[model samples]
Target: MTGATRTTEHSAADDDVSRRLLESSATLSYDPMTEIDWEAPLPEDGYGLNPEWSTLYGTPLWDEMTEAQRVTLTRHEVCSIMSTGIWFEMILQQMILRDQYVHNPANAEFQFALTEIADECRHSIMFARTCAKLDVPAYFPRKDVVEAARIFKSVAGGEVAYGGTLVAEEVLDVMQRDWMRGENVLDIVRTSSKIHVVEESRHMKFARQEIREHMEGISPLRRRASAALIALGASVIVRSLVNYGVYRAAGLDTRRAVEAAANNPHRRSMMRTACAGLMEFLDEAGLLTRPAVAIYRRVHMI
Candidate 1:
């Protein structure tokens, strides 16, 4: 097809995706402030997440941990993940806001992009409150990683920006699916995960559509390079999800806990399984190149 024809088709597809997503959000988006009981009494026996989802769940270290220690560790871990989610949501909000600058405001694409930014703002606030309610201080990514992402979020655009957004959403989506359903999990976590899962489903779809639009006419060389860049972003996100401070906060030896979590086969399996659908989507979008796959393998995301 002609270049003009392809551009027209892309616009049509983008419009259709954005319109449907807007409709979905209007029908079912959440306001966590009113939804969660901020003052509810905490169940002393509830866990922050499913035990199976814990990084050190199957390790010998986990076996040695007292039940109380296990509970503390998981609380710190989930709060750490929420903190990371806040960081990433803020980053993507900036990227999307930047990308939409001076665009045709009448288009559904522009409107949905703004809507996503609004949603992410709310999501970040929700995460922050959850951490506060749990009495867990926010765990930030390493200083250098934060500095690096500062540069990336400011400069990233097009497929690379949308691709990174999709990777983060997809990674979190699979785990939150489990968290939302874990019967023994904390009510706070379960309800928040439910809200996140429902809303982020639309964000993931919007991102996939955005990435497809960006990829439509780019050259193969640029496509491969974009794949590698997005993979690198994914590596940063995976590494930052669980901060080392969490172990210290949980009263475990930071080094030992980190080592155990790093080597846990069960955790690796969980990551790989969580990423399978994401990997398929990336592969179909031609963003899962050899170099990208290699990067994902290093993080056990493949």
Candidate 2:
């Protein structure tokens, strides 16, 4: 055989191995319908929220709604955003998992990502159905440039980006679940939230470990690039909720909601707070290093 032919065959073999790794690790099982007790009663303890939830009350925009409207808004706010966020994230994950199969199919990481893709699908369906049960319509806008960038960056950054995201988000999940410890206002939400928290804990831990491993090998410039991309992805994920039905029911315009949310000082402060907490969490997880920290700080995210 010619040398060129041999090299081509060798490359093909390596590709085959990577593909196999991904496929092998991709199998996972979870039944959304059977996983949570949907009939659970809603807890009454302060509406199952952290005291900081009062921040919503402090906002002039939130005050525009009537008391009954406030109740509807709150319920809609939590379930709708959670549902939408899960839906978008899962869709992105599924795409990424498919790409993994195509690009490096046989790798264990690819396989594991495949399993996660399945989990994300289940989660998206579960959340959508839950929203339907709560009388909220589920809708996702057509993909736009910003959304596309987020999906791309998230997939590119892989486990580390996923982990950093979880660091900011998981604590919110924990806080939400904790609200259910005593009261169950929105029983379905409480139960589903519980299931989510339990499942996401594993994803978060794995992402953190992967990020720590990668950070060691990445140069300072690469780390900054990673941070910026991840942060941009995070920003898009954060901004995608402008079209939620709850905003409509509150007699609010979606565009205005987006604008208000973007320029809101209080929200900015909350963002800083969440990012800071995420940094602390990453540090505790052994991922906070000079380069990573520098990137985060330079971006003014932490």
How does each model score on TM-score? 0.96, 0.67
lDDT of 1 by residue, 17-77 (tens): 9999999989999999999998998787778888998889999999998888888888888
Candidate 1 weakest ten by summed lDDT: 1-10
lDDT of each: 0.89, 0.53
Compared with the true structure, model 2 gives a TM-score of 0.67
True lDDT of residue 296, candidate 2: 57
| Tens-digit lDDT track of model 2 for 1-302 | 11111111113443354344344334433476986666654443323233233234556666675665565556666664665566556545644443353444455555555655666667777777777766666545336844775655445644345553564355455455554563535667666666666555545554554455445544656655666555554545545543455567656676665455555566556546656666676666445556566555543446
Residue 261 lDDT (model 1): 93
Which residue pairs clash within candidate 1?
Answer: none
**lDDT top scorer:** 1
Q: After superposition, how far is residue 274 of candidate 2 from its true place, in Å?
A: 3.7
* Regions of model 2 farther than 4 Å from truth: 1-31, 35-55, 95-114, 139-147, 150-155, 158-175, 182-184, 242-245, 252-273, 281-301
